[model samples]
Target: MYQRILVPVDDSDTSRQALLEATRFCHNQHGKIRLAHVINLAQFTWGGAEFVDVGELQGNLRQSGRTVLEKAAALMQENGVEAETTLIEIWGGTISSAIIEDATNWPADIVVMGSHGWTGLDHLLLGSVAEGVVRHAPVPVLIIPIKRKK
Candidate 1:
């Protein structure tokens, strides 16, 4: 039923699983996949260290984001799914917020993402982006949980 699928990817096993699920779903529906990576410049600038050049750091972050998107797109292509990529620069916003915004702007039929599955104290401290996206996204969200190794 989904025509345009939006998948947010990062350099994590959870994200990889999410992409795999998105690929399978898109392949079944003959849908296109949009892979997005958001770079939050605020993370690199919060300390405001004089030694670090913000511009250079942002450039490097953008490059890394591009690489992540490229690899995810390549994987989708290998799975016989059409894929598109986007790199978003965030000055001040949570990653979940950016993803939700992209979903709305892209007008995606659904959002597919991975959950880190943090619970208890870790969940409280770090917060969950997947949870936030599920709460705020305008479109349907499919969360693929990352299996923890015993």
Candidate 2:
């Protein structure tokens, strides 16, 4: 029985599945759902560019994050889950840290996320975001792997 279930989503199918699962669990248990999307600041890396203004990048990323969260919210609504969505676009931080911070601050009862993202080689080189979150998250985390067509 979860009170506040938090699901971190992106523009990926696996993330969408995580949302579906979280919503189903919350709906059955009469719990509230929190849909969260963290726009990683490192996504705009320009290979040692000197004039990287943190403020400008954060502004752009914030808008993008909001757009992503809006779609997730729409999906939740379609599934009959009235979720309270949160868009956190922090500057100069790791995705795992951003997620962990939100989970701690929001005090979510559970965290559900996709096992991996769109990053292919990068994930292999730098490890997976879901893995990182699970390693550092203070609360319970459930990782759902992206379903690939056979």
Candidate 3:
């Protein structure tokens, strides 16, 4: 019974699954889907060289981000789901804050996202973005773990 659904996506396969799931849910509930992709400026920028030209690189990455959003939007369209999408370029920091900011600012009813399924050392070392979002989000959060095939 979700009205306005929010799904944060990246270029990862897990995010892709989230998109698909959000689309299906939107179709079932006749809700509007808000697809968002946050571009972390630090991660998107190239480092190492002090004198290296980064303007072109940043521009290209922004363009690529747009393409990704368009692609996701196309998937929703093909599935006969009406959706509105936004691409946000934010400074690199904790993803939790960024996600929470979007949820609060956009005033999303619920957040639907896919867990990266980190385990063992990776889980401990990197922690979980999904978990952070769940803990900090003002609204309900639905985290879908990617089904790994054996």
Candidate 4:
């Protein structure tokens, strides 16, 4: 049970917390992890001729994503969890979609991730990626949420 765990990581405290939780979950069994980082290219508006500096900006995003994945992988290693990393770049899609697609392809037993646990105005403004994952994920999702600071 839960032999293949998929974790979506970012450079947030909640994301790190999720990674740690996944590490703990995989420590006892013959479990392995696939760490995923999704980058949304649509957030950037690249205009002007020659595509402006779009390529450079995209490169930066990829680098940043790679760094995040690397750190997550290192954390898993520190906890003695076997983990691999994948980066998904989408020009016009939701992060949750990318995550679910990967989870399905990897055939993960579960998805362990961290959520901001936003609510009220914050939830409305930021929207919840974890909520989307919980709604549509092919595998069971374990969301580790960080408390909101006042």
Specify the highest-lDDT model's number.
1
User: In model 2, how large is the Cα lDDT of residue 86?
Assistant: 88
Q: Which stretches of candidate 3 lie over 4 Å from their true place?
A: 43-49
- Structure candidate 4, residue pairs in collision: none
lDDT of each: 0.91, 0.83, 0.82, 0.90
Instruction: Count the clashes in each prediction.
Output: 0, 0, 0, 0
Best-matching candidate per TM-score: 1
How many backbone clashes can be found in candidate 2? 0
Off by over 4 Å in 1: none
Which of the predicted structures, 2 or 4, would earn the higher TM-score when compared with the native?
Answer: 4
- For candidate 4, the TM-score is 0.91
User: What is the RMSD of candidate 3?
Assistant: 2.0
Model 2 misplacement above 4 A: 41-57, 117-122
108, model 1: CA deviation in Å?
A: 0.6
In order of lDDT, best first, we have 1, 4, 2, 3
Instruction: Give the Cα-based TM-score of candidate 3 against the true structure.
Output: 0.88
Q: What is every candidate's alpha-carbon RMSD to the true fold?
A: 1.3, 3.0, 2.0, 2.0
Q: Tell me the RMSD of model 1 versus the true structure.
A: 1.3
Task: For residue 29, give model 4's deviation from the true position in Å.
Answer: 2.3
Off by over 4 Å in 4: 45-51, 147-150
